[model samples]
Target: MQSNGPLYLLHQGQVVKFGFRVERRHVNPMDNLHGGMMASFCDMLLPLSVYRKDSAVGPRFLPTISLQIDYLAPAPLGCWVEGEAELLRATRSLVFAQGLVRADGVLCARVSGVFKIGPEFTPETAKP
Candidate 1:
């Protein structure tokens, strides 16, 4: 969701700002939360957070080389887990991005990802 990302975007430079709400389905067993979801969230948003790009389909059409995640604390269910991304550095093809997810105003997870920027994607329209 573009709206999810870019919660507070500063169009002043090459970096884009974003955010997303972590729903209960994003939680894991043990009744706390799942690490995979946090990792996935990081993987999905980190690129946008840094590169200043806005297309969510970037993942589907573009490519992600890898995602590194670090779990810091427990993320509770039915709570709003917020995330933020910032671009640190980049090369011609390789770009680095890092982000964090917080629940109930507490730090829950940290993540970094490398991505290859490519052509943007647009969803195909369906005929009714």
Candidate 2:
């Protein structure tokens, strides 16, 4: 589950909503979500934002140069964490996005990220 690869390939869509049933394995010793898990969600958000509109371009598994997140509340085991990302801006070499994560219908995390578009990256090469 820690893998960077999308959990489900069909994960890229306009209304790309994703939810995962949190388990004990997803928890920290404190019975709350481990920070890394939430962090990973931030990582997933950007690539999805690009693919959601067009699956073959915009995102090339680019490395995030900067990622900042805020924990609004605790996320516990057995709760499904779900969220969406919206593209704030897009340029030839960068994309900015924001995302939210809700646990039990409460916003548990909010995030902002920037993706550095890499070489050979262009929307023209996109394929359905």
Candidate 3:
């Protein structure tokens, strides 16, 4: 998935917004955005919703525990995709999140995930 990125991010209070442009690499044979690409994008977006720089968790490295994605429609090639993610809940050791993926304002997919709260995040830990 690393090769599929250069994803753009925006912060809106408790919601994290991600913007992606569908490129040649992101599309399937039918010229629609690939399901795998959408899944990976949601996976990256969900954990970000739990980040709180001022809290004890404080931008921790979150390891995904479970992820579920529902494909609702196809995002055709060359379209812009936006993913809005928000935290559903957070416990002592886990965080749950949900997100909606839209292409040019039309719903394309729904996502939910559970992640394990891990060590504090650092640039070094983000490397593949």
C-alpha TM-score for every candidate: 0.69, 0.78, 0.89
Residue range 1-128, candidate 3, lDDT tens digits: 46887788887555468878999999999999999999889888787655732255557988899999999999999999998877777889988888899998899999999999999877887776
Stretches of candidate 1 exceeding 4 Å from the true structure: 1-22, 51-62, 122-128
> Which model is ahead, 1 or 2, in terms of lDDT?
2
Against the true structure, candidate 2 reaches a TM-score of 0.78
Candidate 3 is scored at a TM of: 0.89
Question: Model 1: how far is 5 from its true place, Å?
Answer: 12
* Steric clashes per prediction: 4, 0, 0
Estimate, for each residue in 1-128, the C-alpha lDDT of model 1 and write its tens digit: 44223243345454443444555556666767677766666776676565445433243333688788888998776666677777656666667777877877898888887778665444563222
| Model 3: lowest-lDDT 10 consecutive positions | 49-58
Task: Report residue 120 deviation for candidate 1 (angstroms).
Answer: 3.3
In candidate 2 the C-alpha lDDT for residue 86 amounts to: 77
Of 2 and 3, the candidate ahead on lDDT is 3
Q: Candidate 2 on 48-117: residue-level lDDT in tens?
A: 6665765444546556877889999988988877877777777777778888888889999998988876
The segments of candidate 3 whose C-alpha lies over 4 angstroms from its true place after superposition are 52-56, 123-128
Candidate 2, clashing residue pairs? Answer: none
Q: What lDDT score is found at residue 122 in candidate 2?
A: 54
Clashes of 2: 0
